[model samples]
Target: MNYKRLLLCLLTGYTFAASPASAFQALQPLHEYDKVSKELVETLEGIHYNRPNIDDAISSKAFDYYIDALDPSKSFFLQSDIDSLTQYQNSFDDALRNGDVQVAYTIYNVYLERLEKRLLDLQEHLPEMVKGFDYTLDETLNTDPDKQTWATTDAELDDYWRKRLKNRALTLKINGESEEKILTMLERRYKNQLRQVDQTNATDVYQTFANAITSALDPHTSYFAPRASETFNINMSLSLEGIGAVLQMDDDYTKVVRLIPGGPAATQSDLSPNDRIIAVGQEGAPMVDVVGMRLDDVVDMIRGESDTTVVLEITSSKGDTQTSKRISIVRKKVKLEDQSAKKEVVDIERDGKTYKVGVITLPTFYSDFAAIQAGDKDYKSSTRDTKTLIDELRKENITALILDLRNNGGGSLQEANALTGLFIPAGPTVQIRDQSGRVTPLGDTDATITYSGPMAVLINRMSASASEIVAGAMQDYGRALILGDQSFGKGTVQVLQDLDKGQLKITQAKFYRVSGESTQHKGVMPDIAFPSLIDKETIGESALDNPLIWDKIHETRYPVYWNIPAYLPVLEPRHAARMAKDPNFVAINAQISDFKQQVETYKTVSLNEKTRIEQQETNKANELLRENTRRKALGLDTLTSVDDIEPIDEDTFAKEASEILLDFIATNQLAQQQAEKKTAQN
Candidate 1:
């Protein structure tokens, strides 16, 4: 049969014998044969992915499956690959069953060679296929093979097989060796790994293949497995079980990306972003070594029921090992309100006068799609919530407003439009273009302007998507003075298209500001940029392994422009004067510098002597925190203790943002007074 036809046949009518009774069901005879046939068919046909037939499809599939087999806990492989590879599953069983090591080695070598070649092809083709490709995988393959090093050549493969047999023999030495004894040991290890496969979850496999296809087409397009979908829902809703931290596997370690406020990890007073999880242990179970494991498998191990304890043995970037005390936290459903825009009033004393500036902390631009689709009465959304907050701030008669969007990873397009509309009069907010060259305008639906007085927006590398939209609109219209580091350049818009049984989050369009500048790879640059504490050595779209390049479209017509020549010239000098004396800013820059150095050094740490390396990391973190506290005190925002540095309302970036806005407003007011005096004199 032709490859395409074979794939269609396999997909259309494939079914397992039945769901296993428990997580520990043994592999049935002939089941292996059935799986191998399906895999071989899929491999030849190339129909496993949503947008298949790409050159990388076969290689991507091989890499994915091989990774899955090695680290079953966090592997991202399709159910099809598992089912197809089943025929070869009994290769180990048959060899050990009949005391045939040579046969087993030969079978493993064939699969291993195919996988290695495929990975090499994937690495070679990636740069040409994708723009701004970082070549991370290629670098990884060249630098380290870890356990996979044993399967490189025929001799190495034979040696690995021999070692496995020798290990089994050594274990049975005390008990005296029998064919059954060696076979049982091999079977137990194989079954233990297989049980972690989660065969029933087809969504897991489908999403991996789908994401690879979408990623190949463009970075914006993605596929979310059922678990990922659930996680997305939790993120959108602003809550999740287990540790309240975002994680990604970097090399062999699962590193902390971001920590959610009020979440167990954030509240624990010990867990930190950039910490590497080396091991994971459930209550009453031996800790499992998670080093060099796949991200998905690690995630599976970390997720559990509410109030259940999972110990995370972590190592810091500086190589300090710290065993986190078993923290007991009841996983509670976090509402959108909890993670939405939180407003506060900051009183700053400048030149013997008190200035009340309104600070609005926007954690994320979240929208409840389920409630909105159902037309519910109380659907919490970013635009709606912020509008209400703006009205309340206006009621308080605040002098100015600072919109804090630092670390916000973007959300709904509607919210971005509405939020921008609050500052600018009714007009086109942004323009979007599709793959087929179709242009669509997304405009402001509201007429009422909110907080038109002095405004400033805060952004950083993590501030992306909807955050970029709002910042871009505000800058384009001269509505708000942009502050902080460059924003995360993620302007692409994705639509979750529901298939018959699954869904595809395809990159349907690319968003551009009213001025026609695309926030693709080059994010929004701030008007008054502040040094960021977070290291950007490996952050944002530009820093990703493979990212799309920045592009622009025709400018959308919008009737808005702020003549800030007089204001900007004077604002720069005044802000420069304050920055010189700002101890907090000085300290923050130093910390940022230190962090960059640490990141550069961290890449070279050896896996051997992990315990000693981890200790150094802990010491570095504690010392940094202490220095930051001292700096904070010097600036009148001193944190008394490290514990006092609560994740709650305590954002140094946001705090500095209020001062930045105050400075901007002060400069503008001074310029306005001078202009009026000149008019009077004339």
Candidate 2:
């Protein structure tokens, strides 16, 4: 199968007889589970790219993953509980090979017990605790689990819970929540968590264990149970009736992973990647705290009939104080047309001259496969749409072009190849190395150049997969200048294989640039870097667990269009000079620096209400000052509060890129004239 299918589509036809057990059974393995486990092991060992040996090393890592997945915050399980399970640390390999997973069920059973006990205790005293919290107490709650150790005794664990609950209460109180409201919300949250623990089943434990095993192989590899497979399929369809954002469980919080192009969250809401979703609410209903809730249940609550509204309370990753705000979105199906490539022309004034620059914004490298298979000559694809937009922009006499691929999570592989060909003459664009060490070079065969002009490609941390292929190709060819932050660094291809019970997504191949550099981990580096609002520590491929290493293969022979380094010396200094005085750039750079300072300075949340309120007020004041600074620089009326700041232009990066392109054009003309003069003198 082509790489375009990548992880999203499934290969069906394989089937196995399953036991007639209820969908939700007691926390135990089914009669047919042993056979399925054996199949899973065999498939992973035989077909996976790594062909990993299921030995003590893998078993040890898998065990750690299993325990961490259940208790990521290390709240319930104690050191004693871990000591008891230590014997099974190296036994997972043997159990999986021999078609047994009793150890997995055993560990899950212990986790359930711990969870139930903790939730019950919270339920019993949370109301009283909420009302009795001494807001002036000098204490702190270490939110970073890695910085704290597990409690050794029941009293220690109780103290930990007390601090956690107090921190929660103080945060709410500082946010203007009444004690009665905090009591009601917290009581319901703990009760719901307790019920979820009681409803744990065999399938739940099995899915977690299987995924732990697969994820240990690579971050992209995963196992999906039947119900999870259905949810995955709905996500792939791009028509799920929801806010259209991918949510993943991060510790006890639901975090937004990525926003789907053309989706409601991407188009309408202020939702952003790495933002933690604290709560969800329906129209006219009270906000439901989703902390510690099962991800499936939260998804169910957020998704509803089309044309309805869903409200989310989110804390942005960029925030210093971790304060939350609510945003409402109207649920709707993500339409393909909304994601299509579009273009506009901007006149950039440089050296007292207005240069018409064309900007083509491609949200994704999408292709209508159905239309192509139906032999429709007028099929829509990124390459075709981009070519059309370029023709239209050429009519406007645009001097240069900018392809804005910011936040463009890629789609079709073929589209990336063809789109690269539009700027350069046909050549190898990407190399695919399969599991068997077979390297296949794929590129555009038709020797046709659609847009041969000065160009720059803009990318950010969210531009990934096919986007990397195109960006890397452009950089390698020296046909276009790459600008913005480093890309999302996802260069491997994965395919979903149907198993007897659940599906296994296995990484089957690796992507390499034509220059022989693997984009698996390092992604494409920009010619000129820009300050990114996205936190690199929380996002990108390098932040993931068990990410594949970056390596290289033999470089393919291709003609370089221009020597990009020669132009960078002239362009970089001018660009830097302009950005130094630009208010937006100054503000963004300050925010990034302040974020780094805060990360180094504090790792805990204060439980004292006074400390928290003071921190919150200081953060709000600083935010307002930054906004007013930008407003004053732009000659606009200064905002009294940060809330008065209107949404800024999304094309700010593209506009700056156009100015850089003007510099490049000027430098190129001067170089050509000097070369001609030298030749004439000789």
Candidate 3:
């Protein structure tokens, strides 16, 4: 089956009655193999949307996913290897159902052979390949080979590797590192790659195949190997007792992908993304090289009891050389205090009058289920903490409010209900549609209004799921205005089920707002949006290949608070006029445009020095232009170069948002007063 036919069938519905919810490799144990596959099929077929059947179409999808997993860059597994696997594309469903992934395992073995050949080729050629930098030498590498055809011949594959290594060296060289140093680093990187490739276990291959199958069902649906399952649990419970940063395998190196806000790494501002972990050590012990080590193994090395310090040897992606440095951080549990909602008051002055805007930033819609189960009343949760914060802010006599739900990727649905309750007084917050075509409304039974005042919910592209529920609720009820970029647009909910001693996270339901809008692919649109740098088309749920489409259902009945929506028409022009002349907003807009253009340009890069130099110069100039423009607007000195602009601490995004709230308060109150006067006279 070709790709087009497979996708056609994926979208076509095929129902099965039983709802229930596989391993091919050494990274996962084939625990209760019979039960896991059976359960997965039942759960997906019975509970999931569209009830996609595991026929030739799904099997073909699994084939594509598994192949993509092994060779994401399309660098390995030549056309011949892909052609050979064509026969097995229609058999994955049958093979996985019977607890036999031997065919998948055999294919993985073929990939292993290919990897060995590539490594040998690298070892043989790299020494002679790193001779000189030729500005005139012409070559082009398709970095994103996902859409590119696979190499039909061995020679084509060889050229791919050759250019790949050349590009690596060329980038380092262009960044101003010495030739000797660049070669040395490349050698080490290759050797580490070889070592890590050797360490790839059968369980890992099984995970790849299993996930391929589940992901074909839905984007959020996934299969986790046992160790990966443990990691998932640690992440789900925000009591991050390990290193504050989430670690992922970037080639052979354990790369710092993101900093958990308020965690040790984020709190200190000592680490940045792309900082590769090379080695780890305790206060008294010798450092252990973690390069080429398994991600879980490296994480284990870094984790320790609270108050214990761990030293990390990092290779910074910034600067000329691959700058290696040691940084130490004391291990501590990522406290609920960190993710907890906090209150602040930003006093904005307009026309000699001040408006105190109460701000409550919710990190995530969290609930301590364990603590609640244990009967602890003092348990920390997003909604409870927010309620307490709102009460405190109310006592402070704030005039307006901003619920900053930026980067809140969501948590407990129960917490979402409660948080939405804080803003909305009555009726259902959102609706959930299960696989059986049954629509259930999740209402906030608690009719307590936390604060009945001028309100705005501040969000960005990172805000999602539970966060969207609260924002959508307030918007639907006309209680508050939504600000910032469109949200992450994740409407589906998942349930984790134990399978083969591992776990399967499957999407069972989707979320719809009270206003009948599904917050699936099309997230909540802001009433007054700010200039955002995020490329929404490429970054959010809309960007995913097989995302659930945006749609509307029957609107649920909900009580309006203060008719904020009616006032938006009068306020939006004021907001837009302010944004038009504002330097920060202008800078952000320019940056957004520049980023998109760069992405477009990055795709067609030439392997020549002049092109590279010119590209680098253009990027630098554009960044500095924005920096200088914003600085000049702020009456600060303009930066001379890119390096000078790096440490400039000026993110006035939220400050500007607060200003917008102040404007809303001033305008809305005046309107309210005018209405009262007219009513009294009448």
Full-model lDDT for every candidate:
0.57, 0.82, 0.72
RMSD for all candidates, in order, please. Answer: 13.5, 9.3, 9.0
Give model 1's TM-score versus the native structure.
0.67
lDDT per residue as tens, model 2, 1-682: 2212321221111111122322232377765778778888898888887788878999999999999989988889989999999999998888888888888988887887677656765676566556656777677778765687877975556667777777766667776889998888788778777666656667777878887788789988888877655422223332489888887888888888899888999888778888888789999999898998877788888899999999998877766635677889999988778889999988887678789999999999999889999999999999999999999999999999999999998999989999998988778999999888889999988788878999999999999999999999999999899999999899999998988887888898999999999999889999999888788877999999999889999999998988998899899999999889988888787777877766654478777677877887887788788878888998988877766665557777888899899889889999999999999999
- Candidate 3 deviant stretches above 4 angstroms: 1-35, 132-136, 145-147, 175-180, 227-243, 247-258, 264-294, 297-333, 368-377, 562-565, 610-614, 644-651, 666-682
Best by lDDT: 2
Score every model by TM-score: 0.67, 0.94, 0.83
Q: Candidate 3 lDDT, tens digit per residue, 279-328?
A: 78899975666655666667877888888888887865442112256778
Better of 2 and 3 by TM-score: 2
What tens-digit string does per-residue lDDT give for candidate 1 at 1-682? Answer: 1323422432211111122233322222222233332332333233222333434343344334434433333222233434554554334323222323233233233433343333333233222222221212111111112323323333333223333233323323322435544444444433333433434233343344334334445555554543555422212221466666778656446777666644666555466556777667787875565654556667777777767777776755322222222233444444555677788888778899887788888877778899989989788888788888989998988888989888788767787888888887789888887665677888987777876787888888788888898998888888788888888788776666544334555565677888899888888998877776555645677866446668878888876566544466766676667666665566555555666665554443222223323545554566557566645656546454443443323455565667767766767677779999999999
Cα displacement (angstroms), candidate 1, residue 610, comes to 12
Sum up the clashes in candidate 3.
Answer: 14
Candidate number that wins on TM-score, 1 or 2: 2
Better candidate number, 1 or 2, judged by lDDT: 2
